[model samples]
Target: MTDFETLGAFYLGKRYDMPSRARRDDYVLYDAKDLTTHAVIIGMTGSGKTGLGVGLLEEALIDKVPVIAVDPKGDLGNLALRFPALGASDFRPWVDPQQATNAGMTADQFAAQQADLWKNGLAGWGQDGARIQRYHDAADITIYTPGSTAGRPLSLLKAFDAPPAAVRDDAEALQERVNATTTSLLALLGIDADPISSREHILVANLLHHAWREGRSLDLAGLIGGIQSPPFTTVGVMPLDTVFPPKDRMTLAMQLNNLLAAPGFQTWMQGEPLDTATLLYDPNGKPRGSVISIAHLNDAERMFFMTLLLSDILAWVRTQPGTGSLRAILYIDELFGYMPPVTNPPSKVLLLTLLKQARAFGLGVVLATQNPVDLDYRGLSNTGTWFIGRLQTERDKMRVMEGLEGVSGGQPFDKGAMEQTIAGLGKRVFLLHSVHEPAPITFETRWTLSYLAGPMTREQIRSVTALAPAPAPTAALASAPALSTAATGGGFASLDARAAVAPVLPPDVPQYFLPPTRDGALLYNPVVLGLADVSFANAKLGVTEQRRVILMSSVDDGPIALEWDAAERVELEPSALEQRPHDGAAFGALPPVATKARNY
Candidate 1:
């Protein structure tokens, strides 16, 4: 028998006897490794589904197993609400003041009551503040909101980044990613395109496949340009223009461009890049439970982001060495439309792929849903465990039984007994069925360490993540070779005295000198330059503007590189940059800070 106290075994709950209506002393210890085959949770709204899911995540984090949770309903943000103190003060800030008024009690009194209730509930389940503290110490928890800044905003800018070598080398995997990415992008533009029939889909997929094959990356602008004039003359047997005419391609490009130019769409490109490695682990290599809250995004935006994320995750998984033990968990709070029966959305392809191949990489996927009928039973065949909670209708019960039987693999499945067990399930009770166990176990869910404050509002999320680190800075010259006077023991005296030739820079350092707007002898003074094109717009206020600023700063011998605070912003167009300096330019002496490309 597995010990419930072991790190690899998750202490879900004690076994329950439906006939006696009593809980047994023998605790149900679920081996974490069994999750390699994946799991599913199905129940009604009031059947404690969220509580069970949250508890499962809490256990995974406590065991130092990293988790990436996709939360469409916003409840997963509660993972950050764990309070080891379990005091009234710990619960006060999250309690609804209106609830206190409804109960004819003061806010403080309500908080105190809630705290006492949690304490008693945990004690009843053989848990306390000590276990909560252990969970807090085990992993770092963060809530990432994709299209909102209330929580940590996730940027999709890296979505167009080139795939790793492993994925690029595998033709099937490469094409799968290309297809999903193209389909998702089109879907975001309100276009439901068929991969084979739609000219728009074929053009985009060809562009992506061509670029990714050569290890080249394409931003939205580059992709738009490619759509106008493709790099390849032929997409297949026919010429590119014959397959997708210029005018038609331009129409597709304009729709995507409009979405890119939307005032609200900028938020999608702002914050941390959607990197699976960063989401699963912190910079220090510690496990982290990253809750991606996408409740704020629209259906199209959600599908786009989810498809890109899953594609990135699949790519990342391919790069990792194979492992048998569970290395990480990918939990989706809702698996409704993303993996439906008949429809083949962009997300469905990646989900099915993960379900089939991710086990070898030790990536366990756990999907939960209230609407079991919306799910595809073919995908469920890969799942090894099922947590069946209370259902509201007999039809739902029948569907769940059918799914269970389909994945049973010739095991003796008694449908009547299973249906009877599921019908008897009450609130907070679940029937645990796993291929690793000979018999399905009926168990009650334990108390969750997080307070179920319901779906959090934007303001609430902001309050929760107020102390997160600021966004990273944008520095272009950081990759340039460092040139310092300290190393050379002299300034650019030769160039300063000659005043006729440009100073020689390393071949790796890219130089783009602006064309002289005014008629004069050009004096090419060495200064670190930074440029940014910013767009400001508000539909409600009817304001829209685009501005470009060029900031130049003289480098010094100080420890810090170019001080942007002291930089001068000049009105200049970045488009006028030339490959070489003016012919008759006089070179100025470069500073120590200007020697390195990183200073810019």
Candidate 2:
């Protein structure tokens, strides 16, 4: 027999004897560390898939592992409802009077009886109030609503900003950023992000790449400006006018600008910036349970947020030092179109990348879905554990079996036995097949510490998140240096002032140069001007210099610090040197100049 105690296992319910129709004394256990290979939970709507997910999360919390749960249906908010001292009073609000009457008891009586049942059930599973309290103490929970203010809203407006310290010199990294940003923006605009076919996507990608190389981070407004007056006059061998005419560029910018100015879309611009470090841990160094609820969002909103979030997580994972221990877990409650078999969405690509690479970084992804047929088995093969609950249809069962067989890795699979086990599963019962185990085991899920209150209302969600303390600033933010432009001897002259007295530009010179405004101000760098204002404003806003610098950390820190133009030095405080849009020059104008600047 395997010694679960030594393996740091989570105790599920006892094994079920199919022939005897009874649960055996042998407790089924899942290895906490084995989760590095990832897992999947599959079942029909009423088959208790959510219960199993809650149970898994509870166990992970108990083990002090951080969790990022994507809740599309909003049921996962129940995690905030802790019932350490379960009593009639604790259950009365959740119990229905008519249901109690049907059960031949008053509501209070029924509540009392249910409380006893839960107490005994937890005791049977070797969990007590002390243990449950410990789990709560170890983990902090926050519910995030991406496009709603009901809970903590997530700002996706600056989601496409360049990451701190990512090497711009790396072609692969640059292309990935461009592709992700372009695709995400297109998805937000309700447009398909086919890089090769969509002219809008291509133009956006070109502009993004150009801006990134210039060391500028564009918010929604900045992105719109870039599209309209692109920094580069030529994209490849063709002129910018020939590739995407000024009229077309303005139209594209207007579409995005409209989205930015929309009232409903403003929710995407509020709240804290999504940082993986804060999502995974709190200020006190305790693990956190972050529930990002997208239940109210439409398909386009969900796609946009999910794509950027996953990309951010991937970037963060690359920075972590691999420990080989389970550092974090990502649980997406519904994985339908995000990992479809036939089509590749931006979210799907990032998800697949995580599935393949996150294990090395100690990040485990758990995907649960009612619709198993929609998933890509090839991508799912990367997952090592499968929790198969009851299926409503034969097709779903068959699809799950195929997925199982694919991941079995040539090991003998007893398909008939698996089919029987899956079919015979009762409510809250599941068949757990793990690559770490020699065979599959059937077990009922344990009682959850959090009450299963169904889907929470907006008010309930807000209350839960409000009670939770805000997460500490991310490590990246804490460690990043405040960015400032090198101070010139003249105490920071405005770009306009510098451009006015600058030498006249040659006719053949392409407009749009990178950082450092010279005497003629003819050579303008949007990156230098924008960043200087950003840094100064951030300093005045009480945001730490480090945090402000971290905002622009996506650029390779070394080159940025060493190569910054002295003439465009950043002022810590607001000064006359601050470039203001003078004479209707779009803030931080890029003058046409022929120099060693790289052209997109």
List, in order, the clash count of every candidate structure.
2, 13
Residue-by-residue lDDT tens digits, candidate 2, 207-315:
7777677666666666765676666778778898887877677677767867876789878877778778878877667788999999998898888888878878888
User: Candidate 1, clashing residue pairs?
Assistant: 477-597, 477-598
TM-scores for every candidate against the unseen true structure = 0.80, 0.77
C-alpha lDDT of all candidate models, in order: 0.83, 0.73
What lDDT tens digits, residue by residue, belong to model 1 across residues 432-476?
Answer: 999999999999888888888889888888988885444334342
Q: Cα deviation of 375 in candidate 2 (Å)?
A: 0.5
Give the Cα RMSD of candidate 1.
14.1
Query: Lowest summed-lDDT stretch of 10 residues in model 2?
Result: 548-557
- Give the candidate number with the greatest TM-score: 1
* Error of model 1, residue 181, in angstroms: 0.8
